[model samples]
Target chain A: MALKPLGDRIVIKQVEKEETTKSGIVLPGTAQEKPQIAEVIAVGPGGIVDGKEVKMEVKPGDRVIYSKYAGTEVKYDGEEYIIIKQSDVLAVIE
Target chain B: MALKPLGDRIVIKQVEKEETTKSGIVLPGTAQEKPQIAEVIAVGPGGIVDGKEVKMEVKPGDRVIYSKYAGTEVKYDGEEYIIIKQSDVLAVIE
Candidate 1:
């Protein structure tokens, strides 16, 4: 089965904490609330959401940081993925 | 001090559960969770938010139903308020 997000939503796989630490990227969350680093797997088409126009900014393969509490978790094909809106993505790592 | 929310945000004061029960309004939350009924105290001027254009829907004095985990709580002038995005407000109670 395939997963397709809707309306500026994105699907991502969490990257290991050790790998993120090795990259030396600073996370925005506090010690008790550490933000997550993940790799973009799928991106939704930008369109109107809640009466507003949203443009997708991150593409598949891009690594991004997002709030820990943002998005919904889904399990598919024996793998877990997080589905979140593009707006919840705080930063993209180059 | 007064709270002025920004970008489709709203400030609300939660209504007591007893009052809601007496009003016979069915809440959306499950047995373990209960959605809150709140009175709109302040509304933000909707505009560009996360690159999207948002227009405020609820105005002051409107009662609304919101997610239990949706918003940030703040104490101002010895009173408590919840600050949440307009999208988090599920419905306006007439």
Candidate 2:
């Protein structure tokens, strides 16, 4: 990825929610809500923000849950990526 | 507010998009995009996440620009409020 996030921002590639856990069952796109899980591709260096020291805890290759609809979607190289601040991330999945 | 956000979560009251700037001019809600501006009504306690120390910067009463569609809407006593993670906030308005 060519995009590097600044501040506490990170680049994410959304994970498509599985609709076909059982064989021959296709639950259609409309049935699924917007995907909130994503994999981190790039991470920004954390620094002073509003005069407070901020340290980045999540890094590249981390799976995270972000706030729903909490990012600016970008299309790069024919693939979709979403950039969101570190704070938008709800939790890191191990 | 009776609700307190845990971790980096926050409660925000959305700002009404001014559609009637010109006198007697009314724009339909359907024609307008989702509002992104909101006032912070509650703040969360920040602590270690992923082994990195995090600090809270924005506080209550700060006007912020959050990611569009980034919050869970709630109705409290006939008023609306949105709860979102701090990372969902894009910028703080001076």
Model 2 CA RMSD to the hidden true structure, in angstroms: 11.4
Task: State the lDDT of candidate 2 residue by residue for A33-84, as single tens digits.
Answer: 2325568999988887555556777788976656544579999999999998
lDDT (tens digit, per residue) of candidate 1 on B1-94: 3899988889999988787667655444444334567899999999998877876767899886665575899999899999988776644544
Name every residue pair that clashes in candidate 1.
none
Sequence-dependent TM-score of model 1: 0.49
Across all models, the iRMS values in order are: 12.4, 12.3
Winning candidate number (TM-score): 1
Candidate 2 per-residue C-alpha lDDT over B1-94 given as tens digits, one digit per residue, 9 for 90 to 100: 6545546778888766563242233333332334366789888677854345658889999988777444565444456666677877878878
Model 1 segments more than 4 A misplaced: A1-48, A51-94, B26-34
Q: Estimate each model's TM-score.
A: 0.49, 0.45
Candidate lDDT values, in order: 0.74, 0.66
lDDT of 2: 0.66
